[model samples]
Target: MTIIQFPTAPALNASEPHDLLLETLRAATNQLSQAGKALVQCDSEPAARVEAASHLVSAGQSIVAALNAYQRGLQHASDQAAG
Candidate 1:
């Protein structure tokens, strides 16, 4: 029998989650912008163009949702720290 050991991720500190989320938000925004540009440059059929646009819109919606969640998490953390 062969035994394999995998390295485990280090535990996150208190502020890491917020930082990580912010980083993710930034990446998502960049991706959304790139997607928008691609949609604009796309010269495919009307249906295909519409589908690309729809995907860009969906990415925008995801960014909005993530921002909202991040804000709520920060507020909750602040409240907890204050009390």
Candidate 2:
């Protein structure tokens, strides 16, 4: 098994879940943009560019999880408002 290590940014610092969600979503957008550029620019070898883009896309997993949490938070808030 080969283990590849990619560069990682520092963890998000936020007191609230919404703050983390927003920060995560923003990071995901940046990663998606860079991934698109990687494929569009083709600055490196085809396989290398694909690999780099794949890593970038994978790095955005936190966004997916954060979005799920954010949706739940919204639903909870809405339920409270309704009651």
Candidate 3:
């Protein structure tokens, strides 16, 4: 079975919200990758594989919501600052 890995980030401080989101997404991707690998490895009674797949789906959905909220928040903050 292949070992899945996370996405690499360029050198950046983690204090920024965008950076934090990117890091979060990278982690999610890594998790999804590992889950996929787990599915491939199982090939039998798929309970573990199904659970891992569920994890991937949940993480992906959460990431999408968080990122969207972050973007909207940033835009609102920007507009407030400008005004």
Candidate 4:
């Protein structure tokens, strides 16, 4: 019999769950912001410009998802605490 093993991600040392989630959302927002600015300022070829634009769109979508998920998580936790 072969024993199966899975690798575990490193544990975080965040003092608060909300803080960690908020930080993740903030970082995602920052990434989108920088990508937008880069798209505006970058004077590269048309292909490169399109690539940057695509990256901005992707990052923005990811940020929205992150925020939505974080909000839902907060609501669930809050409800659990209240009840």
TM-score of each: 0.61, 0.61, 0.69, 0.59
Candidate 3 lDDT by residue in tens digits, 11-78? 44566568767877877677678777777776774566666677778668858965986797689879
The lDDT values for all models are 0.60, 0.69, 0.68, 0.60
Report the lDDT tens digits of candidate 2 across residue range 1-83: 22234445458896666987888777777666666666666654767576767867675676778889888888888898999
Q: Estimate, for each residue in 41-64, the C-alpha lDDT of model 1 and write its tens digit.
A: 666556556655666676667667
Model 1: per-residue Cα lDDT at residue 26: 64
Q: Pairing residues by index, what is the TM-score of model 3?
A: 0.69
Model 2 error, position 28 (Å): 0.9
* Candidate 4 residue-pair clash tally: 0
Clashing pairs in 3: none
Could you tell me which 10 consecutive residues in candidate 1 have the lowest summed lDDT? 1-10
Q: How well is each residue in 1-83 modelled by candidate 4, as lDDT tens digits?
A: 22212122234345555766666566656666666666666565565566666666766676677567668878888999999
